[model samples]
Target: MLLSLRGVSKSFGAVHALQDVDLDVLAGKVTALVGDNGAGKSTLVKTVAGTWQPTSGEIFWKDQRTSIRTPRDADALGIATVYQDLALCDNLDIVQNMFLGHERLRFRLLDENAMERAARGTLAELSVTTVRSVRQLVASLSGGQRQSVAVARAVMRDAQLVIMDEPTAALGVSQTAQVLALIRTLADRGIGVLLISHNLNDVFSVADRIAVLYLGRLVHSGDVAGYTPQRVVEIITTGTLATAAT
Candidate 1:
């Protein structure tokens, strides 16, 4: 397992965001987290990304327990999160966006050539071919192309685990397919992927494992092949397995 959460919980004053939640993300596989609104999915992601500290429980990276108290701590551990916003500057070009905060320096100055070369190399490694050039502005790219850039940026930072939130939420059919294929490619490259999506079709298409969260607790988690879409919906809505209810 690349990442594991055991008995993790988080609270905000009077409200409990997560309670005794357990989850695992394996290298070279996609683990899809599915749930309705207020199901604690966001809370769990925030906790893992170091945006919020867990109230109780342990986080294990590579089977060794560790603490992730801040986003820097998570990044140092090779955990990168791409939120729904993508966080890319519209005015900046691809190379600038990729190395926004971690620009390479040459003689006390930003190395534009080196940065561009590295960005192109990383995109090539990920087999991203939509954007015409690395110098293209982010606003000019399509929805899927923008997603590819965001993911490539994460990979360039040496992220071993990439957590993506609603990566295809606003994309059309073709764009959604493109992003989903990109996700599979990422897993094939041995990077653990945690995908949070509300789309069941997307989940079934890419997830090796599906975990359903209800309210603030995990209700079901199993291989994707073990449950049908209807069964998954039942689990998400009622917090019970179909067989158990039957």
Candidate 2:
């Protein structure tokens, strides 16, 4: 397993966001995390991203018990999160956005050629071909292209596990397909992808595994073949498979 959560729990005063949640994400596969609103999906992501610490329980990275005390810690562990907001600057070009914080500097000067080459290389490796030029400002790109840039930036950072939150939200059919293909490409390249989405069609089409969350608990987790769309919906709403199975 690339990442594992054991008996992970989170509480806010009298409310519990997660309860003894145990889950595993394997390398080179996409695990789709499905849930209704307030199902502790965000809480779980935040905990793993180090935005908030778990109230209890343990997190394991590559079988080593670890504590992700901050976002930097998560990044150091080769974990990258791409939230709904792409977090890209509109004024910046692709190379700048990809190397924003970690720029290539040589002899106290910005090595623009090096950064540009690396950015283009990463995008090409990911099979992203829609953008006119890496020099194009982010504000001019389509929604899907912008998403591609964000994902490419994560890839360029050498992230082993990428946590994507609602990556296909607000995209058109073609754009969704494009992003889905990119996701598959990520898994093909031996990177673990934790995809959090409400779209069952997307999940069934792209995910190798499915984990359903209800009332802050992971009700079911197994191979994608083991779950039907109806069963997933039932679990998300009712937190049980008895009726759906029957």
Instruction: Show where candidate 2 strays beyond 4 Å.
Output: 244-246
Report the poorest 10 consecutive residues by lDDT, candidate 1: 237-246
Candidate 1's error at 20, in angstroms?
0.4
Model 2 agreement with the true structure over 59-92: per-residue lDDT tens digits = 9999999999999999999999999999999999
* lDDT by residue for model 1 (142-162), tens: 999999999999999999999
Model 1: per-residue Cα lDDT at residue 113: 100
Alpha-carbon lDDT, every model: 0.95, 0.95
Q: CA shift at 162, candidate 2, in angstroms?
A: 0.3
- What is the clash count for each candidate, in the order shown? 0, 0
RMSD of each: 1.2, 0.9
